[model samples]
Structure formats: C-alpha cells, structure tokens
Target: MKGKRVALLALFAAVLAAVAIEPAAAQSGADSTTEKLIWDLNNQLMYIAVPITVLVEAILFYTVWKFKNNESPLPTRENRRLEITWTVATAVILLFVGVASYQVLAEPYVTATGADAGVDTVAEDEEILDVQVTAQKYNWQFNYPEQGVTNANTLVLPTDRPVRLNVTSTDWLHAFHVPGMGLKTDAFPGQSNYLLTKPTDTGEYQLYCAEYCGVGHSQMLGTVEVRSQDEFQSWLAENGDSGGDTASGNETAGNETGALSP
Candidate 1:
C-alpha cells in the first residue's frame, strides 16, 4: 500500500511538471486588441487542455502500476458509461477550440487585405497609411506612395493609425514577419501580398525574413520605428517627396542600415 501511494504521488508530480512547462516566446503585439486576443487564446486553450491531459496520464500510470506483477489478472468488464463520458468530453473540448479559432480569424485588424490600397483609399480617409514594401535578395525597401518618399532597411510609420503594407519580392521567395506587431505575410516574385496592422505603441520593433533565402539569411534584419502623427509628417517633409535610390547603390553603401519585409 505504501509503495502504491508513492508511485501515485510520483505520477501526479510528473503530470504537474509537464503542465508547468512554458510555451515558446511570442512577440509582443503593437496594438492592445491584438495583444489581448493572442494571450486570451493561449490561456483558454491551456486551461481546457492541461487538466484533461493530467487526468488521463495519471489514470494510465495508476492502472499500469496497480496491475503489474499480478499472479492472476482479473477479467475486466467493459463500462459503457466510461466510454460515453470520454467521447462526450473530447467533443466538447474540440468544439470550444474550433469556436475560439474562428473568432480569432474573423478579427479585421489581424487579417490581410486582398486588394492594393491606393491614394483614393487614403484620401477617403487620412487615417489609412499606405506603405509599399519591396523585398530583394537580402534587403527590404519601404515606399510611401502618397508622400513620394522611399526608404531602405528601415520602415517608419505613425502610431494610432491603421497602416497597410503592400508587399512583393523582386527575386526569390521570402516571408515578411514582424513578431512584435503580430504580422506575417509571404512575398512572391511578380505577385503582391498585403498586411494590415495598427501601431498603438511607439517604439522600434524587430523585423526578419522568416523564410530561408540565401547566404545573407542571418544578416537580413530590420527595424520598424513608430512615431507620433506629427513626428511622422515632419519626417516625410524632411525626407522630401523624391523617391531616392535604395541602399543597394554604391552612393548609399555606408548608410545601408536595415532589412526587407514581405
């Protein structure tokens, strides 16, 4: 009896340890809504599944130890109630997860746009900022069509406004992912992809080419600077409306400071 109790305690401890393990680190979101939804989904799924996993493992271990080395194994009778209980429980858990996933997918702020956002879209509303993204071998370029300014390596945007990035690749396939902003979109040659996000907080966030491309894969890193509306406008005025040459040029060799997106 003492040995059985010890075995049960060890099994329970093992289950608890498994449940306590933390998940992979996720990037902090730029907006409150996106951040809340992500954390809520993570917490809800863990709450629903952890207990079930613990219970199932505990029962299995207990049964294994209880029956081990028995001189005559007793005939087991099938229990209809046990079967029905597990089946219903599993269905209920899955149903809950499916509903939650749908809710996350339906959120407009996180979804990608299908069509290219134009000046008309921006003129209809000043709140929308359109930044065009072009991805190359190991670099990224950000162009403001409305402002008529182009930047290489660094992307600058205004906080408290919805920004749409129309992304395309010049060569090779790449994935544009900014973990901090909870944005990821694939960049294909000759095809454009769109990503939408609202920057609530003002700061520099890390951007990377999530897809493996070439020799400079690890060096493909960039920064996104989110500034206030007035500051952003001032920056546009300072940089002027001319779409200048990108960082790849020999003239701008020393100034090349950022990465590609999309």
Candidate 2:
C-alpha cells in the first residue's frame, strides 16, 4: 500500500529528473568538439561502467549468498579466450566513437562551406575576410589587420562572405563562439589558430567567451553584425577604415579598389 505508492512517486520523480537533466546536458556544450569529446567520453564510460558494475555486483552477491563457506579450494579455471573477447569488444567500441566524431571535427569547413574550397564560390571578386580575435581577462577584441581596423565588443562581417578567423589570446585562454554560423575556437595566448565560416543569412550573432578565464568570464559577450556588401562598405567608410591594403580602393568596405580623395 504505502510502499507501492512510494515506489510510484519515486518513479515519477526519476522521470522528471531525467527529463530536466538531459536537455541541459545536451545543450550545454555539445556544440563544440572540445566539449563534445568530454561529453562523449563520459557517456561511453557510463555505458560500459554501468553494465560492468552491475555484473560485478551480481557476481559478488551471488558468490557470497550461494557459497559463503562452501566455496571450496576447487580448481581455478583461467579463461584466456574470454579475456581476449572482452578486450577486443572494448577496442571496437572505442574505435566506433572515434569514427563517429569525424563530422564534428570537420564542421567549420569541409561541409557546405566554401571557405577552404575558396570563397569565390559564393560571389565573384570576393575573398573571405580574415579577422584575428584576441582575448583578455574580462573582454574580447577583434582585429581586421587587412582592414586596419580594431574594435571591441563588435564584429562586422559582410553577409554571404566567408570569414577566416584567426584566434588567439592576449591573457588566459578564451573561446570564441558564434552560434548562428556554427563556429567556435579557443583563443590561446602565444598560439594562433583559425576557423572558417560564412553567414548565409544577415543577422546579429551573439558571441561569448566560452572558456572560463576569471571572475568576469561568464559576463564576457559581444555581437557580430552581418551586413550586405554595400552596407559593409558604407559602414567601413563611416568608420574611416581600410584593409591594410589601403582603402585607396574604396571609401567603404565593399569596394575592393578605390582611392580616398585628398
């Protein structure tokens, strides 16, 4: 009576807990390879550990219950074949995990992304804009070396253009992440790495510092503005910016070749 009711309530609580826990676990960091690797390994460990733990517990309980003192000094059988079988099975499972992760490892480019294939595929006379992202203790800054532009809290990109993002940190480690373009990378001090991305639809993508650097880590965030080529050009001109090459090409960002009037 009461026990049955208690059991039902416990099952309901478990179901609610599982539902609440799973979505948060799924969305927290599965979006990045680094986080996914951690998650995948944890999942595998549990999958294997749970069954092995149960089996070992069952064996221990059975042995104690059934053969407390009757467990004789009988012949011990060494099962080399069983050991080899389990070893091979475990290896195969690990191999499967490695193979399954290929897609995640290749996401920033290699798939529907014309970045490595070359940005010209998206539009004529256009190349991907390369931006260097640097991190500090409490904030993020972006540099468009070619454009001779530097700014904080705001990243501007031409819509429909590929961006080759070279990332690094000026202080501790930080992660550059923009969800809309499905891009994220670590900004490690003294070490430079890059990622490729294209903004298909024009919009503002939120940027966050994924790595915990200090007290303000959780508060570090920025915005990336994706605009049309013309709008970008206008914006560049408004900011008096030029790709290191020289705005001598255009007064705005989109114009590849134009000279600033004296």
Query: Candidates' TM-scores?
Result: 0.76, 0.51
Per-residue lDDT tens digits of candidate 2, residues 1-262? 8546545655565556556656665665443233344466555455545455555555566557656778565775899999999899889867766765564454555232322544434367667788877766555667777766776667888866667777788767889887655677788889876776666556787998887766666667778888888998787776654333332222222111112211
Clashes of each: 2, 11
Native-referenced Cα lDDT, model 2: 0.63
Where model 1 places Cα greater than 4 Å from the true spot, the runs are 1-35, 68-71, 116-126, 241-262
lDDT of 1 at 184: 82
Best candidate per TM-score, number?
1
In terms of lDDT, the best-performing candidate is 1
User: 141 in model 1: Cα distance from truth in Å?
Assistant: 0.5
Write down the worst ten-residue block by lDDT for model 2: 253-262
For each candidate in the order shown, give its overall lDDT on alpha carbons: 0.73, 0.63
